[model samples]
Target: MADKEVQNSKKPPSKSVSVVNKTSSVSEDTPKTVPNKGPQVLCLRILNSLNENMKSQKERFEKLESAQYYD
Candidate 1:
């Protein structure tokens, strides 16, 4: 039983290594291409909105700081 467990443990790593090698070779042979633009468009929209929000917050903070300095 102990020998069997040791043999079984050793077998899995070799099998996994071969699978990883095959996948890496396949990806290298395939040309990279964008499958869809939907996710990309959504991400850009979210980023733009966040950027606008940050600009507004910065302006508001500056106004508050200037008012406090005047007082």
Candidate 2:
């Protein structure tokens, strides 16, 4: 078992591992992002939905406040 452990730790004679240890190789001079027209449309739709929800909430709050006048 000890002999096998030693043999396993050493790389196989013919194999050389090209290890990439860096997070990114891109330079600051390169463009940070590629253009995506799809995500922009999605983001606009999300914003519009959120705005609708906010209006609904505001109307509900006003209704609750009006109901509290008699209490």
Candidate 3:
């Protein structure tokens, strides 16, 4: 019984990238929506600054992964 259970567990499960048997034209005509570009640029700059800031902080705090994490 244990061996049967192990064999069943070891069996690979199936996964589908696509779903089947939909009634409607569930396919999208086009993708939806847009995001603000300004925030993205700001985020990039902030992330870069964070990396720089963390480099020094690690020496002060052994727990810190990076000095940039504080900023």
- Which is the leading candidate under TM-score? 1
Model 3 error, position 18 (Å): 19
lDDT per residue as tens, model 3, 1-71:
89999998997878768768754321233223336578866675565566556655756576554646766
lDDT of 2: 0.70
- For all predictions, the C-alpha RMSD in Å is 12.2, 13.2, 17.4
Q: In model 2, what lDDT does residue 44 have?
A: 56
Tens digits of per-residue lDDT for model 2, 1-71: 99998989996679678988875322435443446778876675566666667778999999999999968
**lDDT of each structure?**
0.65, 0.70, 0.59
In candidate 3, position 9 carries an lDDT of: 92
Mark the regions of model 1 whose C-alpha exceeds 4 Å error after superposition. 1-36
lDDT of 1 at 66: 100
Residue lDDT tens for model 1, 1-71: 89998887876544334344442122233333445688976665566666667778999999999999999
Best by lDDT: 2
Enumerate clash totals for all models, in the order shown: 0, 0, 4
TM-score of 1: 0.49
TM accuracy, model 2: 0.47
